[model samples]
Target: MSTTTQNRLESRYAGITLEGYPHALSAWFIVALRFVMGGMILFAGLGKLAFVSGEPFDASGFLVHGVDPASPVSGLYAAMASNVALMEIINVVVPITQVLIGVALITGAFVRLAALGGAMQMAMFYLGGWEGQWLAAFDSTLIYALVFLALGAFAAGRIAGLDRYIEQIDVGGEPLVERFPTLRYLLG
Candidate 1:
């Protein structure tokens, strides 16, 4: 049977108080979300590498023409597209990085780092694929970025994932995270 926990969360900043809000959530639900997100990302990377179009993955065309000209970073995209060396590097890096991030999230290894990377990638995609209307640009990439951020904030990996084990790894007779406190930023 799955269990839910009640939590009261609050925050304060700039002389304003965000009152504690009581909420109930199931850890299993978070694990499921993590799995679904990881699987989708993994498949996306694999699809790129598998190349259903029988052509190597390339970002040049997308960078040059797919992006909306009115996007704030359109010039940056065009510059990147025009640089042969950079494009080549990007072509090879994107899919591999996606795969790595997917695996890390799935396995719950270095989840914070993976989440950060995933969020950054999604942010870039959100900016790159803007469709002109600033207010109407709430898209999948932005949602994905938020999801990644939430996962990191909640330390989802610790809730039934390898991160729970990794955090306890013994280092010189003490738990790894405890021994190196800063590792908390990367592990959970």
Candidate 2:
């Protein structure tokens, strides 16, 4: 490529050239994804619970609309939406889970676990809701799933998150977090 073209391509963004430093965007992207996804989940749950706006929120709408009549699991989601007993249980669980996951991702605490949980939820949604168009409209759920897993695998929370502080604690000559194998696996 011509020097002028190269220079133009390497133009400074936010004062740093991204020419040979693609990962520079990694940190920013992760933080942005974390906040955006976390905020969306948090606000969604809070809205459902009417924690801030006093507007009524219910999972019934999601349950009702999530499934396509032609989809294989449509009967299941439909049944869950229609059945009072199951709906009663799910109504409380879904919102609380979303809120907790949102808090974890936002605070960068137990982010791996949160992301994994979020991924599982998204996968379930995909299985039940997507039916046929897995790539067009419902791909975002899998995207969420992958991003969450990537954040966990990279321990992105430690970059600018509470994990940095939490990881510093030592107990009995070992990090307090080391005591929990699951946490170590997740955070690492």
lDDT of 1 by residue, 9-54 (tens): 6778998888654434556677787888888887778777846536
What are the TM-scores, per candidate, against the unseen true structure? Answer: 0.89, 0.75
lDDT of model 2 at position 20: 49
Over all chains combined, what TM-score does candidate 1 have? 0.89
Backbone atom clashes (below 3 Å) for every candidate:
0, 0
Model 1 misplacement above 4 A: 2-5, 19-25, 50-54
RMSD of each: 2.2, 8.4
Model 1 score (lDDT): 0.84
Q: In candidate 2, what are the lDDT values of residues 20-63, reduced to their tens digit? A: 43444566777788888788888777777855657655667776
In candidate 1 the C-alpha lDDT for residue 78 amounts to 97
